[model samples]
Target: MATLPPGPVRLYGPQFEKDPGALYAEIRRQHGPVAPVLLEGEVPAWFVCGYREVHQVTTDSQLFARDTRRWNAWSQVPQDWPLAAYVVHNPSVMFTEGTEHRRRAGAISDALDAVDQFELSTQCERIADQLIDEFAGTGEADLMAQYAERIPLRAAVAMCGMPTADMPGMVRDLGLSIDSSGQESLDAYGRVQQAMARLVADKRVAPGPDVPSRLLQHPSGLTDDEIVLDLLVVMAAAHQPTTYWIGNTIRLMLTDVRFATTLSGGRASVGQALNEVLWQDTPTQNFIGRFATRDTRLGGQRIRTGDLLVLGLAAANNDPHVRKDAGGAVGNRAQMSFGHGEHGCPYPAPELAEVIARTSIEVLLDRLPDLMLAVPAESLTWRPSIWMRGLTSLPVRFTAV
Candidate 1:
């Protein structure tokens, strides 16, 4: 008879659920790298915090399964809902394991490699110029509402070959999905379901030269639904977090003078600045969850079967044990900002670096060139979710340049 693995850990509660990073940091400080917690009754899980261990565990697919069957068994929602069943269920390159996952991920990886940073740089400059033109003289604008969010959202949508007519509603729906209200979130999920279904159907007839089309033509023979859901997953994953990162990056740079000067120098300088931003304030702060298909030992702890292994990638990035320059300025890109292993984010980091640097500089270099915070640093509202770390709103004042 096989030995059963450990039970699920109750890591998520209303308080920790609301603001997990703060609590997660505390837990790491008290315990070493790994700690056990009970979640949802008696389900025991080990929250992996050590950078090296998290990296190792995530890389070891055989030990810790990335199979959806294991995940669905541990998920919060029932399997019946399309949002639960299809959106998260549809096998994408991101969530699978072993040979199959590698095959699907290869397509995306190849596409990302082929992405031209020069072309992307041109687009970034064009979009930045246009957006800046709109708010050129206007001293006041919601950066998040107007530019930061829309740029990446538009890019991701275009990358998928989705119609522009559908973008506004799609962005709205996906945005609401991340908001606090439960009813609103469900409603947003429904809209996502409807939008993806329609888009997939249209693409099936007339596929374009985009990620979705590539997935459709993939050797894995992904169904229309799978292609659409996977694309949606990509869209949903990239949009808000990238936007938030851009905002946070800009805000942080504006505050730190020496850092700001280094960033303003040129392209290579900008790349280093981007790396610093990713390490300092990683947008996706949450421990993207995984389920243990079988018994496994991680970080000196026994992980039992059916247990939820929460890998706190954010905490690991900030771990004193790993970060070389704990007190100094952002030094090197030694963080898991894009995650690790087979499921690592495949977007061209250089393209993103260009986009963020160009857009942010365009805005602040002129009108808000010396933009200073209107609110106290501590008073700024931090997003409470464990999944992300950013200001909900950051008010700043600057003389019209």
Candidate 2:
């Protein structure tokens, strides 16, 4: 067997920080499924690149613990700083393990069952139509800023029974929190927390039939603060990534001839097409962090207790081991942008696929058939973050429909 790459590549500075897809791709090429990489500072983490290893690491509760508390004390931040605190150890429904996690997952699943997918499809299509109507006359617009980001925010807000008016600012504040790179931005963090707290209070008093209110009313062993955090978590996870995917999809359709051809021909399922977008251009490039609770071996190296492991879901999705369905490559296809295992994103299968499909039907395929990039494709800007991998702006234009 080929010897596993050394302990872990200590990753730092702007280049590695800027775009890790290249680094991850190289690692996968060099080291197969499991490679060691350091995140933040001296944090030793296993980077799993292959689909099988990623599934094993993510689903294996005994070997790797998703709870952030088990790792470093400094990783924990104050609850007042919800974003950082969440990044460290907020204990939202997704991170919990064993029976408690299972129970919470079951509750969320059951609650979601009541939501009508058809209604969701209609709502998403309606939102897409409204956005297109407003911007259609403008002749040009930042696809990411004006459309992609707005739809998901509106959907998430409506689902949580929050006012749509507050969505723009809330989404902006949340974006700032995720974009925090230098000294932690207390102001941005405060704005997000206050907005969430207000929503929590409003939802508690008026208790609408939305996901947030239901979670609060049901009180599944989670406190008011915890419930609010949970809601914020959902918003954070749902909005930006989907927005990024939308922009990326448009970019691919406009630039890649083959991808555009497939969409134009109507040979691909929108769901499958969105999956291709996710695989080819994942919104979040970084893997969810997990700490080792017990001594274990990965990448042919012994990982001691308290060691952190980073599972590169994006990289694994592209791994040779995980074969894509025979259908699509760039546009009309399959991918692992949603992640895998118990904590993997539950939204992508239906919630996400429906949105992308409806949006495609309303916008790219129908409303703006000749949509093309306003600037050279290479001129587009990308947001800098170790977590989310997306373009900052995707300017485009199309012949009036």
Best by TM-score: 2
Q: What TM-score fits each model?
A: 0.81, 0.83
In model 2, which range of ten residues has the least summed lDDT?
76-85
Global lDDT of each model? 0.65, 0.68
lDDT per residue as tens, model 1, 1-401? 12212443345556565555566667766666887865444444567878887888778767766655675344554444322322254466656778877766776656555555566656666666677667656555556666676677666666666787887788778777755356878889788878888877777789777666666666777777666656666776677677877777767666666566754443334445566777767777755466677777777777777665667777788777776666453566557877777766765643554464555555445444555666676676666554667677766555543
Residue 95: error of model 2 in Å? 3.7
RMSD in angstroms, all models?
5.7, 4.4
- The TM-score, computed over Cα atoms with residue i paired to residue i, of candidate 1 is 0.81
List, residue by residue over 1-401, the lDDT tens digit for candidate 2. Answer: 23335666645446565556666777777666777776554555677777777777777876787787677534533434322443466667767888877766655655555666777777787888888888898678888877887787677766766687887777677777655643455577678889888988888788877776777656465567777766766777777777777777667767777666765543264455456667766876666577788887776667778776776767776775655553434443345566666777664334644554455444555677667789998788777555676788888887664
Quality of model 2 by C-alpha lDDT = 0.68
